[model samples]
Target: MSHAPVLLAEAMTALALQPGALYVDATFGGGGYSRAMLAAGARVLAFDRDPDAIARGAVLSAEFPDRFQLIESRFSEMDRFVNEPLTGAVFDLGVSSFQFDEGARGFSFQADADLDMRMEKSGPSAAEAVNKLSEAALADLIWGYGEDDASRRIARVLVQERAHHAITRTGQLAELVERAVGGRKGARTHPATKTFQALRMLVNDELGELARGLSAAERALSPEGRLVVVSFHSLEDRLVKNFITERADARGRGSRYAPDLPPERAPSFRLEHKRATAPSDQETAGNPRARSASLRWAVRTDAPAWGELEAPALAPKAEAEWKKLI
Candidate 1:
């Protein structure tokens, strides 16, 4: 089943579509945005790392063969795939409903399935991280990535429990976390939410991919072309916000060190609006997931693209601790 695109109206309006121009749908989850782009008479290049999404996207490519192409790859690789200047690029980031709903994929705490969270279905699974990794490393990851304050306690419990049996299933892992933090009574959210989120982020290396995708978008967009991104979490939102602010340094706003910021390079983009855009109340009523989603967009400038981007490290201390397991 296909999932409805979040912030649909905001994304489409921000794109300001132009017929016969090239456009990129960077996430291509359910092909909702790609279908809309083709409907607006634009040629679309869609990317999805998930093989299942690419299979689903095949129908759209066939429907508009001349105007659509679907690449079974990550958005970070867009530059390697497409060299053409684009009229617009749209990124719908984070876990897709298709992945979340499929119990076999095991992304949700509510589901009883194998503890697997690989978006591409290849590489180290969450089971490995949970069953392996030091308690300190696990805790650091939870705190840094998931923003869970009780990460140390949760990690300590996971290590103690897994000594008897391998934490191979989502339900097993969830129960361990719940017992550690007290059962979910009068709790605003599930105790395992943060743990699951941290594991997912680490498994996917999502933050690194986001940084690369933003750089690729900056390189590929044409002058006056728009770049629209919709992110579901605060961490994702902060990255997008920083990317735009750094690239669209219109009027001397650089970073926290703006006043002491080094001499400027040629700004490659301009923000259409500074504030983060949110889904309409009506959209949120029908889709609660849209409640936390935030959209940020900018237009490409005539200036040349920046060289390479130096992405932030995912906590050196955590990485050091995790390296012992892998």
Candidate 2:
């Protein structure tokens, strides 16, 4: 009914929290992870780009007082604010339940509302993206971010419909996408789901934030400290997986084709498990949102932090056009 953090126990175990140690909850959505860290007696610093999450966190800040602090900022910028090396850091990536549940936020089409999916409540919204991007860009965004095969069909319809009137409402966009792609008889989800996801990710630059946030955590975590992440989609999971693998030097030396390349960077983090941890059947049944969650964690090593991560240019045409608006 409310926000239940996926993989809470697994993330905590990976953290191996020590009483009085400092921990960072990089995405303090609904204050779930931060609450757990505080309960474990770790001093907590929580960050969220959403103002509502920060307001909700005020209760935890009040209750923990000296033990907890919440900042209303993107997790990517957390290193700038945190001077002390963290004993552990946890990130719960992607949209929070509160955002999806609140129809006014326009993250879902459960209720008709403005097409606005800006996590920070600022910047170019989903409406701007839907109405402004070229057909090719929209198709690319849908395929790249949403992994939807109907992207081209969806984009063609969107362009045709927007000519009569701007696609400015969640319901309006959803209807257009469904009409374009058509419904699958056995599909449980709406045909428009991926289209909406693509628009939302583009609006918020979700992948870009994840890339930067992971690097920030790597830089701020102390040696032996844990870095945990729970991601909801394959795009996010792959990015997290590759980031850790590359940092841990698990990929080995350069390929024979690129033998002239320089040596690999020192392993800054060590992967305790080569594979990601998944939520239990009970957890997935109780909270359908947890079904797609995959948790991967690594322990920081005594090596220097590597250069910052650059978010993959997944949909360059869409991104470039979106940037022009914002």
Which numbered prediction scores highest in TM-score against the true structure?
2
**Residue-by-residue lDDT tens digits, candidate 2, 7-37:** 9999999999999999999999988888888
RMSD of each: 2.4, 2.2
Q: What is the Cα-based TM-score of model 2?
A: 0.96
Q: List candidate 1 segments past 4 Å from native.
A: 250-263, 321-326
Mark the regions of model 2 whose C-alpha exceeds 4 Å error after superposition.
252-263
Q: What is the alpha-carbon lDDT for the whole of candidate 2?
A: 0.91
Per-candidate Cα lDDT values, in order, are 0.87, 0.91
Which residue pairs in candidate 1 have backbone atoms (N, alpha carbon, C) closer than 3 angstroms, thus clashing?
A: none
